[model samples]
Target: MTVDPFAKGGLHQAEAILKAHGVDAYFRSMAARTGDSHAVIDGRKVMLAGSNDYLGLSTHPAVIEAAVNAARRLGTSAGGSRALSGTLDLHGELEERIAAFLGQEAAVVTTTGFQANLALSALLGRSDIAFLDARVHASLLEAARLGWGRVRRYRHLDTAHLRELLAAAPDDAGRLVVTDGMFSMDGDVADLRALRDAADDFGAKLIVDAAHDMGVLGNRGAGLAEHCEVEDGLDLITATFSKAFASIGGVLAGPAGNVHYLRSNARSILFSAALPPASAAAALAALTVVETEPERRTRTLDLAEGLHNGLRTLGFDTRPSTTPIVPVRFADLAAGGAFWAALFRAGVFTNLVAAPAIPGGGAMLRLTLTANHDETHLATVLEAFDTAGRRLGVPRGPDLPPVRLTRGDGRRAGRR
Candidate 1:
């Protein structure tokens, strides 16, 4: 009775499992869509709450035109690795632009965020001990494993635990502490100040993956390291252009020597083809937008406040967060699934997070707010949440006061 892995019943197992958990999830086939607040999902125009276009620059005319122009000039693809034949002037230009914007000495753009982390780890992690945050993005964890490093994980954002680990390691041991600037699922900023201090005290290098914080934080979208005034303390910073940049590529920024060293050592970058000409151009344009349009940051901050305030008022436990990523927590998976479906019917779409993504018995509805969202759309989304909460029989509670960002006191300052 050797059954094929591709058998009909076997193929349907995933669906059945989802149904059992009261989640009728499907990979939606989206039709033509814009990058603004609205998008076409399976022929229905829905207000986009899941997109990472925090600055709404993906469809900007300037960005679009830059991509078109680059494609016309440099063709569609780089065709080879940068070491071989893929290195184009456009690549260098983009790297330099990104480095300047982030106040780094040098930079390298890779195929994706995963690849960037992989490259960094493969190049720098061989003999080093990597101290990772438990809730860090999977890419960094994978990179550490691929690098064959001695990886130790600390509790999420727990600097005390990290300090204990650092204290135990030998002073001569090469230590690298890595974490996500803003936890994607919980939308909470990392305690960069504490991490930096720990790294300095332990004589370790600090690396931050600001994939979600870039272009969504800081006065000029410089990310959490800069927002925390630890830019000088950070030894390396890796981020993706896909989020707020509205392009497809990952960037590694640090000392010029390190960037130069990675170019020849990282297998991921040495073998894979370079980013397309258009994508590089689009990232440059998006960076420009993030620089010139500070209002986008203000508006998005307001939207995040509104959503956080509204969700708490509806009696959902949104784990302590101070960014655009808002997670509405549920006691069980069943309720989380039902709430998601009900919210969809109410004309809102959000990510349903469970199990491994969120460590615990509970689940979450991860909602992201973008600068493209207006008051009208925000109101609609809030109403949908209200309806879903009622349908799910979640108790309503008094609105908790909003978490305000202060100038210095080291809590929730300047976006990150």
Candidate 2:
């Protein structure tokens, strides 16, 4: 069918495409919540298995009290950009605490994770060559675009390919190699060790977006860099507070001078309002949770094991996931949508990933686990998956051996 170019049905066309592709997203409002375990969505208590709340501090008394107290003391908003009057005491304290937690010399908090990448890339990426992993977050890609850098994408988690690109790029140009410490969708940790080696060989500074790694990996949830023994190897580490920190902001942790440079040169930070008092305070409190609660990390891995093993035993193709996020593989969009819908009807909520998120035939259900999920919660999530799997007629276990879930840096070399 031929369609008009300037018609009044752009919205209709978009909706048609969504329907054609079986993208029926449910818009349920959540009213109450607690940790990674459970929440009240649409007035019904649903096990929240898909949150990045790795440490389950989202509803912790300390985090909640910190936010509440901060709002009471400083009001709701910062009202100005960080460059202006928005650089409040709370932001300063959070930055200091976060930097210390991540083993960095300094940190700068931004309005969101996207802003953190946008600002840092803008500052550090002059006429440099940026070698990014193919699956790196969109924020980093956007930042590269804004930074006006020579952007080259290496195969996802392929260190040798990245090395070739870095070697071929002009050595005289500033060099920044960016990757996600833990890939968001697939829930697989990056090959930071290999990436670091390549970066060092080529003299390219390494930047890790640890949004999924923070508060989930490492001895004290310091992130993939610390877990992979590359905390110092990386030149910069950026993460989002909205995930494990349970707040609405992002922070860039690295050398004090680089952060200072970002503060001065990054337009995103200069133009956007700083993170509000409540978010800053909550993030500060969350850092305490990360430091004190080692069991949260343990529980996170345990829960991940339960769900990963459960689904695998039921015969669904869950990809190699050592982290809390697992992608249940489907041959195409049809099966993915059917599985997603079945899971929803079975009273479990998971992120449905399809085209644009995955390769054309690589559609899958992205299941995210949290440390807060107890056996009961995980069982419920698995039961839903089993139901969905049966309906979709997808084969259960693979011919390959069972993938064991382990702790301490889920990186198996060349396994990506």
Candidate 3:
């Protein structure tokens, strides 16, 4: 008899658990009308609390115009890798814009933020001892795994533990300390200043994946390094244009010589096609918006604060998060699935994170915010949570209103 490779592994186990809980709703297809605060899921219009479009620039008129203009001028795709025929003037413009925005000497754009991390990991960790945070993004972890280096993971957000790990490593070994500027799942900002200090003390190069922080943190939206007032201390910074920039690409920015080295040595950059002309233009335009419209950042942060407070008041455990990505924790996968379905039925869409994605094998409803969300939107979200929490038997604080189910037409379907 032939054996199925996945029949005995984690995939098979996951299937079993998903089946048991009827939680397959988590994987169902949902489409957004635009990258806005609402989406169409299973033909129902739902509020989008799960998106990464922090500044709400995804649907901005100028960004759309720039993408259209670039496509009209340079065709749809780059047609080749940057090493060959793919390097467009638009790409160079985006790189310059990013470098200028971040106060970095140079910047290199890649196909995705994940690819940027992968390329850096392959290059920087090839001969170094890579000390990674336990909760870093999977892309960085995969990069470390692929590189020919020894990898050690310390407790999440524990700089003291990080120092211990650094102290244990060989004195002569090339060391690389990698972490996320703002952890995506937990929504917590990293102590970049302390991490930079640790790196300096141990002679390790610090790489910060600021994908979640770009356009959301700092005075001018320059990201975590700027937010921490340690812009000059970081050795390298990587971020994605997909989130706040409302475009699809990633950037690695740093000293000119280091960026030049990545351009010449990173295999992903050499082998993969460059970012499309439309994406490059869109990213550049989005950067312009980030620089010009400071209120968008302020509004986004304000809305996030409102939601975080509301959730906490209702007795949800949203830990260690101070950013737009807020995760409401649950005890297990079943409870998370039920809570997610309850919210979905109530016309609020959120990302349900479960085992394998979440650390420590728990689950959470990953709620994110955008500047487009208004006071009414926040009110509606809080109301939905109240209803969902009640129906699911989750604990709640006092003074919340009774449960009400919302129909597809945005009217109250029924009251419980």
Superposed on all Cα atoms, the candidates' RMSDs to the truth, in angstroms, are: 3.3, 3.2, 6.8
- Backbone clashes in model 1, listed as residue pairs: none
Clashing pairs in 2: 315-396, 315-397
lDDT for position 326 in model 3: 79
lDDT of 3 by residue, 191-213 (tens): 88899999999999999998988
Tens-digit lDDT track of model 2 for 112-141: 999999985574445688888999898998
Model 1 spans > 4 angstroms off? 1-15, 20-23, 123-126, 395-399, 405-416
Better of 1 and 2 by lDDT: 1
Could you give candidate 1's per-residue lDDT for residues 1-416 as a string of tens digits?
99876765432453465589766745766676666667677577777787777778888889999999999998999888888889888888889999988889999999888889888676544567899999999899888888766889999889999999999986567888999998888888898999988999989888899999898777677887778787767788999999999899999999988888887799889889898899999999998898888788778877877777776766665656778888887777677778877877766778777766778767678887788888888888889988877766875555565555312222356432
In candidate 3, which residue ranges exceed 4 Å CA deviation? 1-3, 8-16, 31-36, 124-127, 396-416
Lowest lDDT block of 10, candidate 1: 405-414
Candidate 3: the clashing residue pairs are: none
Model 3 RMSD in angstroms: 6.8
| lDDT measured at residue 83 in model 1 versus the true structure, 0 to 100 | 89
